[model samples]
Target: MAWNEPGNNDKDPWKKKDDKNQGPPDLDDLLKDIGNKFGGIFGGKSSKGGSKKGASNVGIAIALIVGILVYAFSGFYTIKEAEKGIVLRFGQYDGTVEPGLRWKWTFAERIIPVDMQTTRDLPASGFMLTKDENVVRVEMQIQYRVVDARDYIFSVTNADDSLSQSLDSALRFVIGDSRMDDILTSGREKVRQDVWKELDDIIAPYNLGLIVVDVNFKDARPPEEVKDAFDDAISAQEDEVRFLREAEAYARGIEPRARGRVKRMEQEAIAYKQQTVLDAEGEVAKFNKLLPEYLAAPEVTRQRMYLSTMESVYANTSKVMVDVEGGNNMMYLPLDKMMQNQSSGQRTLPESQSRANQSINTQSTAPDLSGRADRFNEGRN
Candidate 1:
């Protein structure tokens, strides 16, 4: 039977001892009963006043301990390997925390985790006026990372946004100072370097705590209306550079050969000079030796010299022509044809011509030209 049914009066679950009411007990009475039970467990007397006081004290202590444990546990957080945690106490800078599990005052402190190792890319692009007042679309990218957590958080309201604006300002300054042709072509690298330097200068005073690792010149081109013309100009510049390099290479190749030819000419000139000097010296020595002989026997020396000159002149003559003194007739000797026939080994000369050649060779080799002078004198006598 149910507790509320008849003959179940003594089995009422909500009924207390010495209670007359059948409904639930009063709130104050129920609380008093709970306090008495707790007080009894803690060795407090069952008197109403002592039980209530002991229970109240015990409950407050237990609640305070539980709150402390919860606060300590909740304060624990982890800093990753690449991050540095910035701790703030009462909305003011406190200290920094390294990677690992860390704890702080739960409600009195806060941590802002900043990634220190990751590289981030920020791009700046716009159509800007060049030094020549020409508008060109230029795009650049900078790789950066946070270096100081405190400065990154406290120095600026927004560090990343500040860096981005700095980039834009630096890029615009450099672009405005550069020519459009350079921005779109060969000067792109130089422009990129200038922008990097300018950006560093701009952000250094602000202390945004960001360091730029690299600056890249992504793209630069004339406006779409002038794209084709710029492309043509760029191609022409490339061709000009290529031709200049080719000309340099050609000059390099020809320079060595020209130098070699000049050296050879110098050597030949020196040899010719030396040979001329030696020949002149030899002629002077010959004249010095012959001076005494010429003084002693002038006629005989003159005749010998004349005969030697005639012999040397005749040695090179292949054909000789002699005119008869009294008749209108000339005699021609074809000595070149005779020599050619003898060399060919195909034709034999007549016996009379062979004897004549032998006699001519013998006379040409005779060594006593001075004796010939004496023979001429004897014939004269």
Candidate 2:
């Protein structure tokens, strides 16, 4: 038989091996499979065991690389300026970490970034009794900054939400104890400050390291249905105060002037009285000074004063008259003609002056010379 025939014992070209004659695996071929297992055990690159070992090693290397990368990523973290990073090791707080790039243990640690510079707002969420015993709805906003990161993260479960709820409770407590009228008007500012204080007190007991900022009143008013009435009442009160102030201002302006006018009138009255008294005193003094002079020479002064008064009375008149019982009566008593006759020496003198000039003793009117003028008239006729 030829060697290439069915009796040929040479290795097949596809085998590519020198002491190996296995094809693959066969079902129900127990000895063949068992013999092939021994060959593959000793086989090099073409063997299945070597391929499996290499594949497993390659897969293990890929897993190791992936694990190392994860570890590096766990160590890397960024902390912004406004943020604080809190690390908890297996649910236990370690300490506080500030901003910037940082590296920490990766696997068993936890990180929470709390914003340190953010402003939080908390609203008043309940009915509060004001100083006036009214239930007023006052919404307050609180601004806060995170000061302690470790406390913020570990002190409370949810720090921001917890503080918000606590703020409402605190505000209600403060306002419920206050009267409504005071809250609406004067106590609002006090309520704000008190709310903040109470919030601090409530939070401090829990070791919730929170810095309370300002708490301010948002809207302070009565309930909606009574808002208008309150407004009207407030406006009426305002008008009353305004009118009172205006009246006070008017009084302040007029009082001084009124007082000044009264003072001026009083001064004028005093001056008038003083002048009247002075004039009366002057008249009395003058009368008192002249009384003695008039008393010293009563008849002479009276006669002289009477002559002066007659001259003054007759100065404007153009007539004069004199008559005696036993004396001659003139025919024409013209003032100009009598003066001319006296000057021309054609007038006769009266017996009174003739008796006084001749130094003769004259008989008085009481000596009964009754027929003298008749006898003289008859002799002249």
Candidate 3:
């Protein structure tokens, strides 16, 4: 039977010895009972002295367990995508942790999150002296990112500040070495490139754990006192550059045409030379054929040559005026004009007009050369 079942008054476990008082259990006795139950785990005997000591030790152990659980849970951390975790073990450099939920020894290790993928911008601007001893205000910006998290944390006291200082130093150095005109005008790009290169060279030995993505020359200008003058100078330089570019473009466009024309002229000259050579050779061959005739009859050959020359000359001339030495009459003809008129307007002419035109053409063509024929005949005789 159970101790508290039915009506078994003496066997009831809940029945207190002091039931007449009907009060809460004694605090000391309740603690002793709980202690005795836990005491069994540490092999403590169920006695007054052992129970009290066991209770104290059990309470301390519970507290320690709770503290350990809290510490373990606290060590867990999340690294972001852009960040890298640098793990230091017992205040000494250890290894790195990737992006995820990670745990470390609570009081012994440390994690410093350095954002490696995020590009950070640093700007440097101030009045700087140029190589020409002119003071100018220059502004420059640099984009950088942490490449080595461990180096970033340990190599310098503050990586970002150190990088900033390096950039400023590099900018000033380059500016001091450059001319004011260069910084303010056409050489701005060169200044930017020089600063970038100098910054790289400066930081190369420091191991700043930074990589410069790019350097930008934001602005550069002369002092306010000389602002207008410098603006005018810069404008002039820009106009000069524009003119130079236009000239180059024009040259590029014109060069091909000029070359084409030169080639065409060369080809024409070659064709002309070939034609002249061929014509000269044909004339030489004709003269060779005439050599035999000239030797056979000198006077007849001379007369024929003169007539041939006259015919060739007359063929090119559009107008002719002939004056006979013995006669007082002069003959004039405008054959080219008449032929042009006939071709331009092809009007039907009367029969008599057409016949006159035919007769005139015949007379002009044959030229009534009886006098020349007689002269040639006499020479032949």
Candidate 4:
């Protein structure tokens, strides 16, 4: 028969016999029964032998002590040298912890270790349109390190991804305003600087707890379809720059030498001008000193001047003339022959006497002496 069914009188298995209603035992009754059993084992003051209340108190104290020990030990954790710990108490923001041993309640608090000292790289690249409407592929890398652990974890959904997006935006913004030639060649450093500045500005308001360490402009190139043409153009530009540099260097090296030559020539001209001026002044002074002497003795100074002039003129002549006192008989001297003999380291007769004797002998021996004299006089005329 079922326990709750009306049937032959069999005692209910789940309830006491004196109770009229048959039902499951209450929580208090079950507790009292367990207490009675524990009290009986410990020799309470009954047939069951001990106080149930005292045994219950002792069991509760032992459970409480064990729970406290487990909670305290579970709170101990270590934070590494390169990491900063962000503690959250009861799922709310708490204080930060530095590197070392730290303690927090196991269930009530949580620790998130963030690496603050390690550098991270975020690479950004894409094909962008230049201001000149040319397409180019540019790649850049940014190095960053975490500065604030709390902000790194809490300020954004993802700091690294945010940085990457910012980098892309900055790179595109700068590239969009730059010419293709600059992006692919000489303007790369300027582009890199602009991108870095733009990226910093973009992320500054968000406080993503990141500091940019360095920016690397890796590479930039024109589209593959026109790569060869652009390469040739770039090579031409490089050669042009090299030629310009060489020209500048040559100019620098030659300019000083040219200036020195011009200066030397100028100094020589000045010295020559000064020497000419001094010589003119000396000649004027000499003429002034001789003027008084010439004025005092007119005939003598005139004759002396004439003789001196004639002497100066005749000193350079290679001929000798002899005047006969009574007649028009003139003798020509072969002074050129005498000079030639002297130049040859040989001796010769005196030019004046030799010329006089030659003229007498020629006149005595010549059959046409009168015609020779006439011809000589014509030549002299």
Candidate 5:
């Protein structure tokens, strides 16, 4: 085919101009022709052995050069102390690297770093009701860390935001489910445990690679909206307690006083019994002292006693009559019978209650009868 042919010109675009009066070959174009002619000479047409191999070699070299450049520029990575590295091969998670310098496939692998340190707190503040119908406000704090690096990378689409959202949900469950009064002060420790447990339950299902350390209650107080009402209720409760305490104190005070009074009464009874026994013993001692003298001389002592009795009787009687042998003039009176008569309302009386009755009853009966004194003189006195 000649370069001037229409069909030949269509086959080779370079011959679009007049081929007989060819212009000077371009340097860039000449180099391409040389490569093509040499490759055809050595290569076979049936299998395209040499030309195919040479093209393949050139392509491979270009790729290697680009790969080497990429590696030299950025291939090594370093994870900080509080960080975890996740390595991905072809956009898929391959392995996880801990805190250290590690080399990975630059073109075929990607690395992601996640913070493994304690994260920002999620403090829950709200008011809720207890089982007993009491309302209280609760304040809480949450601490967490990153545990799994692979899961942090590919298990979830957005791991960090997912962990935070799960934490928020856990806080809501702990605060809303638990009783308000318990959350405030009494069962704070239990609430913290529950919060942690709930967070774990939720995050584990999501595979977000979050690890819960602890949940703590910082400050729990009444809401400002109902502060005055709550304060009033508390004051009422305190008043009731104070009243009960005062009543108990009063009872304690009265018990001691009553006990003292009882003790005093018992002491008085014992003292009276002792005094009576002492008086009886003193009387017995006086009688014992007089017994010896009386026993010394019988007749003389008897006469002396009789004379003394007459003298004393005369000293107390204004008038008296007497008869020897205690005859009819001696007044037949039953003294013992009249003394025991209770209907008379008189006992050891007349002499003490009335002098006239005493004189009528005993005057003639108890006349002076001393042998030493003249009988008539005794009667007259």
Candidate 6:
């Protein structure tokens, strides 16, 4: 039967044989027995007085060892190459740490790592009034990096946020001082430069510990309400610039050719003038050389000059006239006309025989030809 069952008469299975009516041992006695067994295993005296004290000392030592391990492990940390750690002791600034493995008191110090080498971007965009009282939407991008870890962490409440506000303020200030046409077109670079300068000035006194690497004027445009009109205006402006450049190129190309033509004409005129002057000088020199000869023999020179002049005149003439000394008739020979007639299918005598025949006819017609020839010679002398 089961122990403590009605039929078993509440018999205790673990009781001694001499015990009677000692139903179930007392709770305090059982606890004491368990404690004595544990104390004996751990080298503690099983006597009631010394066992409690020995157990308490063992527990205190274990607690102390655990606390030491937790504190040691919690202090170790690592910093990245691009980061700088800001240490604070008892909520007050301590010092900074470089990148590497480092340790600090677990609950006494705190480290805040700031990324010093990372380039952060702050964008500012809004519709702003131009100097000409026009609204323009301008978008700008500011690239920056943290220069001082301590200043970045403590000098400002929020460095990035403060920088963003400064950027907006600077952009607006620059845009407000600029004309709309410049902002939308050729003045973008100037606007970008102005914004960068103004932003730096605004943050200089605040010591935000940020270095602005570059400022990009991302986009600038008129509002959507007049987008098409503005686009047309911009296109027209572009066309004007293109036309001006093309015209300048054309002028540059044509100027050289024009100058060359002018130079060539000037050279040609110089050559013509020199030739004329040289010819006149040669004529004067020849006349001077002939003056003495003419003075030495005036009549002979006069006759010779007259004959020479007549020879030169007749050499270029196609008609010839001969005056007989004592006859009233003059003979004419149209050689050029005769030659044209002959080529047009008319028969003509040989040139030499024709001249001979003309001479014979003239001699036969003239009377006293020798006396007339003597008279012409006497008249010339």
- The candidate that wins on TM-score is 1
* Model 6, CA-based lDDT: 0.80
lDDT of 3 at 142: 89
lDDT of candidate 2 over 204-269, digit per residue (tens): 877676787787788788898999998887778778879999999999999999999999999999
Model 4, residue 268: distance off in Å is: 2.2
Which is better, 1 or 2, measured by lDDT? 1
Q: In model 5, which regions exceed 4 Å deviation?
A: 1-70, 126-138, 159-190, 204-207, 219-224, 235-381
Which 10-residue window of candidate 1 scores lowest in summed lDDT?
361-370
Per-candidate local distance difference test? 0.82, 0.69, 0.79, 0.80, 0.65, 0.80
Top model by lDDT, which number? 1
- Residue-by-residue lDDT tens digits, candidate 1, 11-91: 787788788678766666665677667667767555555545755856865787799899879999999999999998999
List candidate 2 segments past 4 Å from native: 1-66, 129-133, 256-381
Error of 3 at 184 (Å): 2.7
Clash pairs, model 4 backbone: 43-49, 44-49, 44-50
Please tell me which model should have the higher lDDT, number 2 or number 3: 3
Q: What is the per-residue lDDT of model 3 for residues 1-381, given as tens digits with 9 covering 90 to 100?
A: 765455545554545875743334666666667767766666766676555665675686688789989998998999998888988888898999889999989889999898988888999999999999999999888899889888888888988898888888999999999988878776889999999999999889879899999998888888899999988988998899999999999999999999999999999999989976886687567556765666567677667766765665455334545667858765666777878876654465566555555434434433224345446667988
How far out, in Å, is residue 3 in model 6?
49
Query: Per-candidate TM vs. native?
Result: 0.69, 0.55, 0.65, 0.66, 0.45, 0.68
Q: Which ten residues in a row are the worst by lDDT in model 4?
A: 362-371
Q: Write the per-residue lDDT of candidate 5 for residues 62-169, one digit (tens) a residue.
A: 677798888877888898989878778899877778898888877789888888775755555656555555566766777776677767667889876786677667
Q: Which ten residues in a row are the worst by lDDT in model 5? A: 363-372
lDDT of 2 at 189: 88
User: What is the C-alpha local distance difference test score of candidate 1?
Assistant: 0.82
Write one digit per residue (lDDT tens) for candidate 6, span 300-332: 655666666556545433454466796976666
Clashing pairs in 5: none
* Residue pairs with backbone overlap in model 6: none
